[model samples]
Target: MAQTAGVKPMAIAGRVASERERCIGMTDAERAWRKQWLKDQVLASNEPVHVEEYWRERTNPIRRIYRKPLDVLFTTLAPVLGQQRAADYRYITGKLGLIAVGVLAVHYYFKYQGNDWTKKGGWRMTRTKPMVLPGQPGFPYKSERCKDSDYADRGFSKSVFGSK
Candidate 1:
């Protein structure tokens, strides 16, 4: 190839030569860490077409937020469960864990959907749009806004307005 300084990256052909040499020089721990890190990055960067990406996208924010926790749980439990001998945790927590999450997500969706009396302006869940009026649902302020937009009145769009 066109390798220079014996270290500079070249096209696929020349780069592989240098990389193989470098890889052979690493310690066992370094090689293992590099390998595991690459796998983690791949899982984290699940492409749009991957099944994992499909569920993650369709799931709501509440369920989606638990991916890491489930990952940790499955990873930690896999070894204890005797299904996986490796420390990577993919054995017990990868697809099966995601499937469990999917089940929980569906359960949550229906559970709340059925009991959504609060959708009628009970607490934080409101189906109807907020009205834009004083002391209304979505009004900015109960009082008045400052003229300067720097002081503090009630609500003048921004708190920058000065209040009398």
Candidate 2:
């Protein structure tokens, strides 16, 4: 090859060394065969081939098969807790176990005692009686019945024993 103007000697020597190394491992006949094969490959193909097409032609069909559901689940759960970079599985499992134990403890406590001990003093239970509102057109304060009653005083008499 003719030397170009202003070309560095180190660059030219590196290129020559790389070329020599490439051919050095091959036998004379094997080198010739490789050269001819490469020439044929370059000259035979004029059509544009996509990257996907090239891989599909070269790769095994079974190897290309994908577990989509597993991949999606792994991707989703990886951030939460798994073999992912952020958190170790052992630590996460321990924390989850503690939480489970706490939940169970609370559940059993409530089941046995029927109330929470933590908030025992915070809350109180009280009974309330229903009030009778005045001027509702049902009964008078001191009278037996209202003026519209069909059976006078019988319906209002039941209120004394808290029957109605």
Candidate 3:
């Protein structure tokens, strides 16, 4: 008859209203106990809920590092270099060829040449003098320096050169 706060009256037909009235005759405590018992029965079931397991599995952080296209190409090709047999070598070589062609296609699409600049019109290029530091000497023109600079040390140099 009277609406309670935050509660709306159900728009039930005559037969449904009679059925609901019969149902509502049960005590509040009885209804509450039955509701809690149903909830307990649901939780006590033996079957594992895969939905919970799926969410729990997803909570783990993924550790793999993301690689760029060039990084992936090099990484794949590096292992193939160690292949010894002719068939394996040929297979790897073909894969490498495909990767190279893909790289070249990307290079052409991006219009990136060996040097950065692309000359437009009939522009002439000018050569610039190399900038040298005040104290540091310019690059050695034609001298043959030892490949290993560790041998440049006095004690090691004599032993390495067999002049000690």
Error of 1 at 11 (Å): 1.9
Prediction 2 global C-alpha lDDT: 0.53
lDDT, candidate 1, 1-164, per-residue tens: 34475677545422223576656686676667667755655533444354877787888888657666765666577767664453455545567867998999877766565333234432233244345777766567333324554333222433343333
lDDT of 3 at 104: 89
Tell me how far candidate 2 lies from the true structure as C-alpha RMSD in angstroms: 24.9
Q: Which runs in model 3 stand beyond 4 Å of their true positions?
A: 1-84, 112-164
lDDT of all the models against the reference?
A: 0.55, 0.53, 0.51
Best first by lDDT, ranked? 1, 2, 3
For each of the candidates, give the backbone clash count: 9, 0, 0
Which is the winner by lDDT between candidate 1 and candidate 2? 1
- Using lDDT as the measure, the top candidate is 1
Name the lDDT value of residue 76 in candidate 3: 70
| Error in Å for residue 23 of model 3 | 61
- Give stretches of model 2 more than 4 Å off: 1-87, 115-164
Residue 96 in model 3: shift from native, Å?
0.2
**Candidate 3 clashes between residue pairs 3 or more apart in a chain or in different chains:** none
Error of 1 at 37 (Å): 26
lDDT by residue (tens digit), candidate 2, 1-164: 44756665553223223566666586677667667755655643645544868877987776556433344555577766654532354445556867999999877765564422234432223334344478665434344335564332322444554355
